[model samples]
Target: MKTPVKSLISGLAPVLVLAIAALALPAAQAQTAAPAASAAPAGAKKIIRYAFRIAETSFDPAQITDLYSRTVAAGIYDAPYEWSFLAKPMQMRPATAAALPEISDDFKTFTIRIKPGIYFADDPAFKGQKRELTAEDYVYSLKRHYDPRWKSGNLYILENAKILGLSELRKKLIAEKKPFDYDTPVEGLKALDRYTFQIKLAEPAPRFISSNFTDGSFTGALAREVVEFYGDKIGEHPVGTGPYRLAQWKRSSRIVLARNPNFREVYYNETAPEGNARLQAIATKLKGQRLPMVDEVHISIIEENQPRWLAFLNEEHDLMEEMPADFAGSVIPNNQLAPIYAKRGMQMVRYPRADVAVSYFGMENPVVGGYEPHKVALRRAISLAVDVDREIRLVRRGQAIPSQGPIAPETSAYNPKLKTVMSDYSLAQAKALLDLHGYVDKNGDGWRDQPDGSPLVLQYATQPDQQSRQLIEQWNRNMKAINIKIEFSAAKWPENLKSSRAGKLMMWGVGWSGGPDSDTFLALGYGPNKGQANHARFDLPAFNKLYEQQRGMPDGPERFAVMADAARLMVAYMPYKVHVHRIFTDIAQPWVVGYHRNIFVRDFWKYVDVDLEAFSRSKGAAQ
Candidate 1:
């Protein structure tokens, strides 16, 4: 968690501000000398610019659910613990805490300590005084989720987190018809002192630290006075003790973050790896560098693929994330970097994503969500009708692997051998199921009809993007084989997400990454998650029971058994058609150094530096 890293930085404060010792690589792994003029910036400060595939809607961590917004929030806030920057197998280190939490009472009690002297960015909420960060701030921020007015998307995780008195306090607030008294102390989430915070849970949960608390969005420290100062407009102005501060924001256009002048002095200290030839080369150039090497960050939205690619090619954007599916073949032909980009010294990074992309059928909608025998049959028939193999092969351009279930490949709980129903191509079997349910064309209209002679039409909500269109085309082709007619309801991603969360959409497709925890992967089908994470609104007591069973258990064979059962049940219900696990790619110019992909962390502009000399030359030549 961020706590250990926090301790490391705090301890290393003496040496962090000093000049860095030049990293030296031996003859074998050494980098060649760069063109002298392109080695360092002339006189100007360096700024790193990139693009988000879509615009973020909010900066408030509690309200942000989508990945784009999470990326934005991560830069402005620090999680209690951050993932180890260079640890293989992905380890957690404290980012802002003094140490790893001390657990007592058989894991039910957690006590955390924070180092002193850290301060938030300059804000009027401090009333002309520096607002030193303390343990109480985290307590107030965590309690904000249960205030009932925030309508936090993260409420389920907080409420069900089994925090000893937190849930009871929410119930008390509702019963008394009183607004949540933030002043009234909740014993379960209390600050023991100015620097020590204690949390008591209802049960033993050893892995809860990595699952719920490690979520960068879930653990960012928020100050109460700042919230009160902004009130309804808090999202517009974010103040945190992170490495960067929100400087300028134009909704749907651009966002700029400036390095915090008061940020703690920290250098790059990582667990040294050995024997990996590629990592050795990268380490030779960056081992002792100071962190947050850049001065400012500029992020813009470019929704279309063509313009985004062209901008990267024109040396306008520093990084091109997610090579378009249409161009994957041409860009990285035969799994090799194309000569055109290689000639310019562009670096390509590709790795398996920690998430799975899926399409869900609304379990409450009359056309799809239902429990009757006929309704169940229709859903299963449609699931079988989807040719997921074709989607992975054609739409993904072989950049993905067929999903076994909701659990992603990155998780230890993923079972490659788990049999997923309707995952294979079987049009004949799909037709058989439909025919048995009495689905036939009553008016010779060349499409299936409901048993009661009503037209069965599927209305799906989709984003207006080239990739989504390709996926829809594959789905339509598969449905056509069964003579089922479907239509599209197009909208922006934000609108589609809003409609889905409200249970207004009959069907919609999305992606989710549960990180290292299988509980998150299984909890998507939990009954209480309806209108939140259970986008399908699928509520089965049997499934929720299993979800709880797995949630309480730590990782082991017993937990794996429960996870497998939950996945099997989800496959049987067929609320979602999970097709692929993607291998995302990013191409960065030669001037962008120290670019590496972490499966969990997405916002890493600070960890990267712009080789000013090279970047300046590239820009000048482009003009």
Candidate 2:
């Protein structure tokens, strides 16, 4: 599935760092000579400052696997392979329909034909020598992910015993005590030539095209020479073939990115027709048509909420993703902020699914390592014990919808015919099921237990958030009715994610992206993914068969039938109890241009032509 863009910078109260380039330009020349100040010569370029959320954790794509790293990494790196986001959501069905038709075709094995003339970013530490990106770069990148020394979080994404030899390679590397080789020859990845790359999957993956677009998950082409010389500072000053290079990072304060003069042109063509009014207005902004409309994107890191909103309103930051709802509704409406809003605007976006925000509840299946007993009826009762509807209304203010299966309703993969395990707030039924499963409190200590007087308690870990706390409280209250108590502990994202992966967690909130394709998010059923708790360690042979079948079937009646069966089986088993899929929300000032109204906000910065000169003048007048 597609990874959501992480790190939305707050626009509240940002302390502006005057760009060196901006400060150097004469004030009068900037205001009166807009063309001179804003325009880029045939070869020269202009820079646009954008507000990015997280500064970034790791520059190394292999080691970095989160929202914060993925979005920024995209610019720095180039993929010989890339996915095309279709205009229609949920159109990426298996067999019958591939991803975008323009993407590489499968010829026994998938191979991507690269567009020529592309080059990687120069290694600043290496005398700024530019290296041509080649198919070998992809091989090196994948090897980095599988390298044990690198310990990349995404190692499992492309594991191949035949190609990567992860099991054998790691074994030998441990014995030899050598640095993980980036060029470890594996059958899964091969360079047809300098420009063509062939990626071999263990099996034909219907969602491979969409999966390639995700950051951190898929391997990106890297310059070998760059990695060799600057192996130590690679994460600090990463090099790639992105539109913008990391110029400066002022940790938790600001990051400045300059235009990559040698960067490739716009990746995708999203041009609207000339007759379209939106296109006409957008076209007029480009007085001097350059491919990438924005020149310099300056990201300021403001963690405090109030300041971020204030900055956006005052026109300090162009755009702010993850804007607080209260600020989005109340502040931007002010006429005093009219001019700031005049230049740019905000957009509402959601994935294929609506209302459903997926929340993961740990299931005790021991295959991966779950210790919980295998009781199908007990799992059903647990689902019956928790009222997802009430939780949605109370905890989420009815902002979300109750979901029973992994596939969100908005996705075409969702099977509506499946029977939902709706908990009707019936504590008696839950107690009856527990009794039927032979669990009761013989000593009457205000808690249920095994026949041998063992206490039945579920210890759940959750993030330190008000919403999570409230959900735990609700679950605790309902569990009391069945004389069962659950212990709640608050942990950070890393710990929760780690424990969940180990299948040691009892319950936690998990958000997954359900892209246009069904198989994209089907990793839940993969054998290796089991026991890493993953909320549910369900090893249903039937579900696995259906999942594998759905991947090969075309997008039609038969595919839908199999997908529906899978969804029904998942809901019936109650492997993971879900509540909602936390959608990404953002608010931007009107002057912050090029914001899209779609779920996938790719190329949002391409057409935006912000009037930074106006903001400069406003600041000058205020001073």
Candidate 3:
């Protein structure tokens, strides 16, 4: 992934928050991060209440791709490697692994040693024995993705990287009608001893570290005993060696995480990179501090933005993350917090959002997919017509930057000067491109016809929310300007995701938060990822070849140059029209200290601290 471009909010403070004086906010259904609690009201309860607009679907990252799920899993699990909580560039450091993996010169074999003395939170499956993490646990955890029964959505990463004999082993089990034997070991992935494990790849997968192979806590080890213990209900019962463990869950309504007493003590020892002088200064305050300052985390799921925002305003939430863009001006007028919120000790911190919101045209769908001129022209015309600039101003309320290509700013391979016609908003050019492809009004219906004189209408899967309605209206207006007939079909994100993967949805728009490498963006168009990561179902031999070549190479100009060629090819074909990179504002109360959003990380519950005494005093004064 490309390094994120730091979005500068000219007058915003460098500190996450020094203080927010407000009445106590309820802990849930409003919003939810940062490291250790700073000095506040004496003896203040160290607690943080956060909210999310979308309900978390599953606790298993292996089954789900939504941000909500990832957020929940981050606290419950631990990965082999984790991004620094304060490191701006997000260097991956050791988690369960003792150190970075020892790699062979060919880069195909990676040997990792698990840290000794690490143990999972106590679970019933332990059956009166201590549950310690082992190399075999990691191997079993990884193999979970290949179990055809679970239908894990993340198997693509492992398969693409070609982890030794894993795929062949999974294929053999599937073909032979035999259950996967956890006791049986595959040579490609094996535990040489209790503490050591090795992974041999069929190819030189340079991005193995950046990919799902070793990133978030979700990729942490799994106890086969625990998985079998929970059986089909594993999603509800997550067992890991992370800082917190799931305590209470009322699906779609609320979740409570309690500090894991069994967790080994870990502290925050990160320093911000050189250029970010402000973060570096803040880091000093938190350095050497034993982590998980907050005692408990309460999360509420409020799907509607109106109520969610209301909860924050009512002081029922400690932090309101990514304030709804629709009411941006009302809350943060002219790039400053409105007097109403400012006087209440709330401040707006605009951070560079590390994601790209893109609308992809399914390349395999009959209406939109093809290498032929008519299909390609229609895709190109639609891409050129979408007014992403208008989207930035009106829909996003200037909280987003128009995407230049697949890679957004703040990631690897993200070139600011790379040219692409998809980012060019032009109605005339769209119409001319259509006309050139024989797409014109053959009848008097005010809509263009396909080259075969058939009525042309495109379907887009969309959400039923007000924001989506407004966005679809914008699409209609833009497409109307180019005489294109487009229809919208409403569905929830999960349902839309199903249709999209099945190649049933012709067009849809969604956000992709890239990992720590550029391949995260390029894999969108890679052929083998079709029906999986390749939501566009774009199949091109040349693109696939280049994607493979780049994946096998490490991060450098040579690899980036190759990835750039793939992006250029994607831009030319327009399988996905570049939309806008979203920017969000995180607001914190005065008493909330040591808080700042990490551009690409989610597990900070351990680092955040609270001042309940100050909160009570503020509320007492108000009352």
Candidate 4:
């Protein structure tokens, strides 16, 4: 579940009625539906099985925004740069590029040269010809986001970078109501030659390369022919030059990926960070092994918590990506793996996720949205009424820390020492604020009315799930204490997301995961990023100025100062009531080798291997 920090997408799973049906089925019966784990014959294929709590939206790099879809796209597409899998301090390494990008002294220009001989996965779009990846492919890929036809959710990220002429070209085409001219040359983004491309920014951007180009899922190169061939259906038919290819897709149920026979020869040679014994051991064991050690990767979308947990426990899946908070006390008691599972050779990796769960108020909505004093007071009063500490203890099961502002953890701009009223919970203050703003019980009704004596019912959008229900119950209690009327509109995650981006939903609570760049979280409040990364549509000029001021300055105390001021503006406006930064616990079975969660890296499947012998033994022991 990738959130809107990068593109305003939600990282939480959307519960479906199908999940309820799965819950009714027994664990053994559910396991029977999945691929069997029996011992394979000689020269058989090795498979690594896992389950996502949410379903993927699309495979195309330009269109998809969710975490599950990006996870699949990361394995299939090759970006110029990628995060080092085993690095502790988080370093960037060349993926398809020949070397690190050559940056100008001003940090306004970046030149990258891609390695030759890399070819796309064989597809009919190429007319049975070998489609070699070139510098032009990246140029065209970046241009795709600007095209009005695609309505890309990630357009704001590139637009914020202010590439020299690319934004101008897009604006010209959009103004003329003409088709995007892909062949038109742009000064900012250009293919220098056969293998080299350069990007010139309007202003200095020290972290642009690492922030935008490092993740293949966000800026992966796409072949022009494939995009033209698929057209409207391009998202369903993704063709790329990577370690794996999509073998099967069952809509929201299952997805299968097989090793790409045409993939380049990539070997496991990651450097382990010093003093980290676990990574050193993994590096030593996997060195020299061919990339994507597994022959096939099987993924299932299990939206319900118990069924997804049961799938991992029943060995239907090899890894449980995120441990459900409902079972945290029993599974990983006191932040340690339970003895019962530890004795079985299960591995647990616990870390605080770089994300924030936020409930945003659409600034354009009539009921809860406005910049005026009274409207601002209404939102702030509501924020103060909600108890974040209670939500963390009861709903989150103590697996989260209250967030003070928009900045996520593990970022250059993040200051743990900084505190504000973003997480304050006080019913008395909330009531007084509302009373001061003229919101009172009019017509003798129990609920508080608007200052104009109209109904002040809050329409909140939410998904149907056990966790969501618990969170909503907390909202009900909080609103009741404040004498405010609130109503929930239940819908699927995807539907709610569509409504959210369209600004149709008055309020929706979702989590946003931070990307490699620290500026991503703050983009949620940027004025120009409205309806994209800025789901709240918070258009405050004071905050926007601070955001732009920090973008040019190199990461330092000065830039941090600007970012802190921007975060303060976000808090003062109360467009988004940021709740908590969650702590995640992922568990892997004994047979899964090189299993480690990298916060900055999305494509970890290539570095992991499955121990077939150990898997077979585990099955035998179970019998």
Candidate 5:
């Protein structure tokens, strides 16, 4: 079996090198020792500063779906399991759990034992007493998804698993228009003891634990007292047992976190994969030190690429998470760090991220949405008109590979040998399809009209950023080639996400990042996922059946076959145009230590450190 990393490298080897290489340094610069800690005053705080490309919506695990919000929530919450900080071929380890989960032979039942003595950050919700984390917290946290009040974007994942008795309770509450009862125990989710919880599913879920429970940003435990106390404002006031706590939040402008004084003692002990000299060096230098070596983290939201890049160049930020595609040529030309940055001792980590950027059409819209043959033809024609290769080469600056299907590059379901019409660009075929479907310029206008002689204009929701404008320009050119009229609706990312979830947008383009399991990408077309992850609202019964069938089967030929069928259905129906799987490059300053880009791990703040003395000296030298 080919690993995700190997598969990614094999797919992009011709155009790019997929290794996570730390740029080499000159001998003179490499031998210079880091400044000693004694150069700084005693008890001085170590702070790591960075910027996010988009604004985060909420800190609550259930309410957030965007990457930025989840990244912040991962630091504040503790899930049952997490990916090892330094492990390659990513390995899952216990986070709040005492050990790995105990599962039944059939894979339907799961039981986890929580570690005792874990305490949430001090909050008034506990009434002046320290509140220790319990298994019941996990139980309540999972139940929140089924509650109609939160409208969780992740509810579909849990619902598809068919947890025993939980869905029924949610249905009953919905029918009665009553509030969810967290105290009422369901057969599927239960607290067996003070520090143990058990969950029973209606069907076998082979990858459920790793897919859902491993990421703290999505499945972290929550306190009942905290939820009831804060009510609708729970997103702003996050209290958890993780290594960091939310100290201040300025909405989209800024966010700050402080180390949890009562956090449990966790040492920097991780096994690095053999033969990767970069990871081995990091492990050797930071071994035996305490986790979350920094005292504070400062995050600024700078949506534009130019300013964010300039901030890092000016040393105002210590790390740049995702190097903007617009500056890729100047920053890392030909997949190698440029001399300007390499001379400054800046480090670059580059890898093919496990994600797909796509444009989805709302399946319920009147003009472009329907199950009829004509409507399907209209969608397929539009898909064929998009020049994916041109977008990747010009707009993305040759930093991405054309996506052949919904499955991202780094997943078991992703077949490198598979080729489909999803990435094809043929203006001639698109025009023929539109003519056959009655999309014609009936009144002698330059643009095409609907079959009923109505204006056929595509309203696409977009953000007001430089990248988005570039993408819109691509769309305009592509649509004009086929004589189709199109318009853009500009809004902030959060506003656009809200409208998309509510099914108010006619079309939108977004990206989805995969987790440890492959089923996550397929969930986009699952019928049950329609108001949540399925932004297109595609309710095809055939696709939904295949999605359910694969969830129960173990990792083998049978599951792979089912996933391929589902992916084919998505391509045929043409609800989404999966454009590309992006390659990301993150750069860090010389003062930043132990920084790495792990696709499966979002809670990485705890694994990194900062050289306070060196940072101070750099600031002085800059002045």
Candidate 6:
């Protein structure tokens, strides 16, 4: 729960972000300022209400890859291992405070130390008073990612050629050998002791610590019984040792959680020194305090935009994740939402984190049934016609970075020296390209025409969300001024992704996201990966060659060069028209505390120290 040193934003900056100290305010101060409760149950547990736009697609970690479910699941399970956010890159201070296993200087053979006294979610089928988590349980969980039957999209974490025998284990799973035994043995992982584990990688990786233990989106330990019964169902029925437990998942309605007393007490000081030294510090700072300042978290499904904003205003919800950038001026200026505006709140945190802003150009290839063979030049011309900087200033309202290529800003692979493919919006240049491609407005109907005299019109599909709709509408206007008629179609988020990947889309809204590693970004441009989900399906041999080489190289200046080469190819081609990477912000009610937005700290409530008494009163009045 401890905040780390602040990070500075790179690319187009001298911007210095500051690490914010916790706000100095007593719970009583905020509680007393609120309206009187309607009718109070004398000692009801505190309930924190939250709002999310999309219902979790599923709860199984193997399937549920979005931000929503991961945040919720962080609470319900306990891993044999945990990470400390306060530690620097490549180092994860243990949750149990046990001696760290010795790792080689090159990071080839990691000797990990496990902390004792951790337990998984209690289940009747496990046949135990309490299921204690052991090092063996972690071995089972890590191996599960590679199981062919599971087909975890995240298996890429271990899919690299460097993972010895993983390919063989995957083949065995397909043949139904139950590749790794949860009860007996795990093939690639081993338990050296009751509280110690070891993993053998085919090669040294400098970012292993960031890739596995500390990062929230990556692997963590799992309970054997929990995985057996739940199996693939673990996504929805996540059972973890975090601060909260799954109470209800009402499908498209809402997901609920109840605080775990066992975790609250244990994780209270897990980040600090252990034994008497930790106990003394905990007591002195908290004044004989216990764990878990709050009792429950209730996530209300708000698929619509208006409801989400109003719910936060009326205090019906305690938190708002990823506030709409267009509404920032209106929402952040309000006194009730000031907590999000403070230095502590606005400070951007990146984890192997890269900028979220990038553009997806629909690179049409005649070989793949793309735009008409004659329109290839037109597609490339349209890509260059976009004015990304203006798009950021106008559509984004100055909250994002104007992107120039497929690669996100400030990432390890981002190439600063690439020849700018999208510079200066020149209408003359656009007109010349159109003329060369045999486009002309012969009748002067304010619309371009093909050689055979058909109108040059294309449809751009996008999500129906308010922000997206607005951006698309504006983009239509931008293209129209140039006599290129564009039809904007709105579709559901999931369906839109499907349509884009299937190449049913000519052009649409697209964004790039991934961890710090270059491979994460490579998936979008790699020829094979591109054919699958990358909407543009840009098949560049040079780009694919570099992406493969960058993955195995240890983190260093050389790897940077390799990744930069891949990025340069993306910029030069202009596959998708560049846009801006807007900063994502989460807003919450005054009483909702102890939540860190760190991607590594999956469960905000684990560190959550909320005002329970006030939360209970709020919920009672809402009912």
Model 5 spans > 4 angstroms off: 1-38
**Candidate 2 lDDT, 1-623, residue by residue in tens:** 13322222223222232232133234333444344333223543334444544345676787664455555665556554343323333222221112232333432256565556667666565476656666677667767776776666655555511233545676687789976664566566777787666666555555555444343224556676777777767776777776667788776567666666777655333444546565445545553555456666677755445566556545566665655433332333321222223323333332233223344445553211232443555556666787776765555434444565667555556655544664344667777888876778877787777645567776767655444556677878767767776788887555666676677766655555534555545555545555421346666778878877776555778887787777677666666665554433455543454444444323345446555554444445334
Tens-digit lDDT track for model 3 on 195-261? 9989988899765765664444447667888888998888898888888889999998999998888
As for candidate 4, its clashing pairs are: 1-11, 2-67, 3-9, 4-8, 4-9
What RMSD does each model have against the real structure? Answer: 8.4, 7.3, 5.6, 4.6, 5.3, 8.0
In order, candidate lDDTs are 0.76, 0.54, 0.77, 0.85, 0.84, 0.57
Which scores higher on TM-score, 1 or 4?
4
lDDT of 5 at 211: 86
Which one wins on TM-score?
4
**lDDT by residue for model 1 (1-623), tens:** 11000000011121221211111112111223332234454567778877777887777777777777777778777767777655677787777788887878477788888888888888888898888889988888888888887878888876666897888888898999999887787777899999889888887777767666555566788899999999978878888888889999998889999988877777766554777666556666776777688889888887777667667766678888877655666678776777656766789988887677778889999888887778888888888888777776677777888776777787878876766674666789889989999898999989999999999999988877777777778878878899999999889888888888899999888887766666766667888988777888989888888888877776799988988888888887877877778777889988998887776775687777888877765554443
Query: What TM-score would you give candidate 5 relative to the actual structure?
Result: 0.93
TM-score of each: 0.91, 0.77, 0.92, 0.93, 0.93, 0.76
> What stretches of model 3 exceed 4 Å from their correct place?
1-45, 275-277
lDDT of 6 at 608: 52
Compute the lDDT of residue 543 as modeled in candidate 1: 87
TM-score, cand. 4 vs. native: 0.93
lDDT of 6 by residue, 1-623 (tens): 10001111111111111111112222223445656655536576667677767656655555444556655655664543455533223235555326645767766777667666766666654776776667776666677776665656556556553555665666765678665543444444688888777777776666665455553334555676776777666666676656667778787688888876456245354343345453344334544235455677788877765566556645666776665445544445422344534422322221223544444655663321244534555755665566666666655545666555556543556654554655447667777878887788977897888767777776776665656665666667667756787777877766766566566666666555554455555566676654343557777888878876776578788988787777667655656565555555676554564444544455656455556555566544444
Error of model 3, residue 279, in angstroms: 2.3
lDDT of 4 at 191: 97
Alpha-carbon RMSD, candidate 1: 8.4
